[model samples]
Target chain A: MIASGYLISVIAAMGIVTFALRALPFVAARWLQRHALVQALGQFLPLAIMTLLLVHSATGAALAHAGWPWPELLAVALVVVLQWTRRNALLSIVLGTCLYVLMRNFLV
Target chain B: MNDSNDPAHGPQRLSVLSLSAPVAMGYVPLGIVFGFLFVQAGASWWLAVLASLLVYAGAAQYMMIPMLAAGLSVGTIALATLIVNSRHVFYGLSLLDALPRRRLLRWYIVFALTDETYSVLTTIAATTSDRQKLLVALLNHCWWVLGTLIGALIGAQAQVALAGLDFVLAALFAVLTVEQWRTKKSAAPLWFALGAYALAYGVAAKHALLLSIVLSLVAGMLWQAKSAASGEVQR
Candidate 1:
């Protein structure tokens, strides 16, 4: 375990970086608003970032174990199907999470 | 556009808390899981509360537990967090024109623009009063903080049978990705993400997420530039 002082500092550091990122465009509002590169990135980056996060979550178990994470894959598939058909975020997340918990404990 | 400001349709009639109530369904459970994991990783409840209060980025907070347990350096943790929450930069872009003019309120809106809040704000009509927008942002922020406090208190008091609960974070991300894909109906970003992840994983298994994010952003920009050039030639 790390020291308490270090942990607090780490948390503070994370907060500072996060707040800075959030404040970037607001701080540089004029330049960012006029910059074509920033605009193009602003449009495309959200989906790409979301997809990257999904991959991070999906591959966490598989990467850790050096094998395919069947349960996670299947649960994510279920989430996609549920969200697509039902069009409900809460339902899809809750049901998919429950399925993952059940599968990891028993099936996997 | 002007209906929201009419005396009959005043802010008092539309309680900001009600607008934020729907988010509780998502935030409460996830916050509890984060708190539970934080305590499970042998951290104090106060630390969990402080992190949630200050950082307030869900995925980064989740990643912090494992990183902390592994005794990583503070600088490394900070860098990892910056990468994980880098998406917020773009989110801030989308809200630039809509954010309030007052410096303090604008800064607060910037500080509280979480993924959920961004989605809500962007989907709402542009005519929404600045007051309503700020109210929604503040209310959602409170929900997350309150949920984290509750979870930390519970996790500190008793051990809960939450063996597989960490997967909630994964599920939440999966759902959000699906939602974004559905809205955009574009496969290019998804393909770029997969390609980046595969390549990064081959190079560095542990840091693949950070690497893949950087790779994907670069690849996305290149693709955008190429497409723009081609359009110029055609025109």
Candidate 2:
């Protein structure tokens, strides 16, 4: 039913993008594995990418705001402190999300 | 170094099978909801599978249903999907270090960049080899394909209720996070995430959250290297 030409086209575009990203290393790395430059870069790349992910998750995509999105910020802060103190990711996300809802409801 | 010869394949396959019980326990309801929502949005079962395969980003898939429900444009949908999944770009880069040196292992590593694979791979990294990494990637890929295809197929015809199962993914991530914290010492990644979130929010207005992820991952690596070097010197 949702078979419009545009929707199909969009899906194809997405497929191409996803394929390219996933396909690059699959094709390139097969031959280049032992290359020194490649090896040197490999060690720290994951940490870097992950850091960006955490920061984005923590701050939640709002650069240049006046007061900041207090609730989301608060939620991220709580998750970090709890995770740091207790090393608990589950509690961090659950409690953080709860805090997010509360902040959305009353904090702002 | 062929895929079939990967030593990591055993653990990777085991982990895939290992996670399945939980997913089967989890995906049916979630898949049904996705199915119902897709159907409600005028998409066929076939379309759901296409979306799942082409755009395997989970939350984006859920969000797409609503966007379609609202009759949004294809361009708008594409842009939204891109933004939502922008964080995923980092996953490949991370695999570069451990899996990059071996070209044979590298190709398979990139194909399996889903959240589940990341969790499983990160957990087994210290113990992993080229074969192991390939197995992990391939096995993880199988899990997503199975969960998604099964969900789409079953969800299309029936009204199975998986309301609270949304938390299953959170729960899975929680499991992985706890394991990581207990076994490893690099809490910086988490902190980096929080810090990045804060920074992106404070200055930039464009989905500070996404910016934080990219920035935090970049910065986190810098800090990790700095600390690793200092630690190496102290030793």
TM-score list, all predictions: 0.85, 0.49
Interface C-alpha root-mean-square deviation, candidates in order: 2.3, 7.1
Residue B44: error of model 1 in Å? 1.0
Off by over 4 Å in 1: A63-68, B1-13, B122-133, B160-162
lDDT of 1 by residue, A18-50 (tens): 999999977787787776666666556667777
The CA lDDT at B57 in model 1 is 89
Tens-place lDDT per residue, model 1, B104-142, is: 888888888888888788877778778888888877877
Q: Summing lDDT over every window of 10 consecutive residues in candidate 2 chain A, give the lowest-scoring window.
A: A56-65
Q: What's the CA error at residue B8 for candidate 1, in Å? A: 6.1
Error of 2 at B231 (Å): 22
**Mind giving the per-residue lDDT tens digits that candidate 2 earns over B1-235?**
5754788565565755664444344344445445455664567667766666656655456656646766678776766555445445545555656664666666546545666566666666465557656755665455454655666666566654432222223322333344444444556555555566667667875656446646744564566567667767999
Considering every candidate listed, which one attains the maximal TM-score?
A: 1
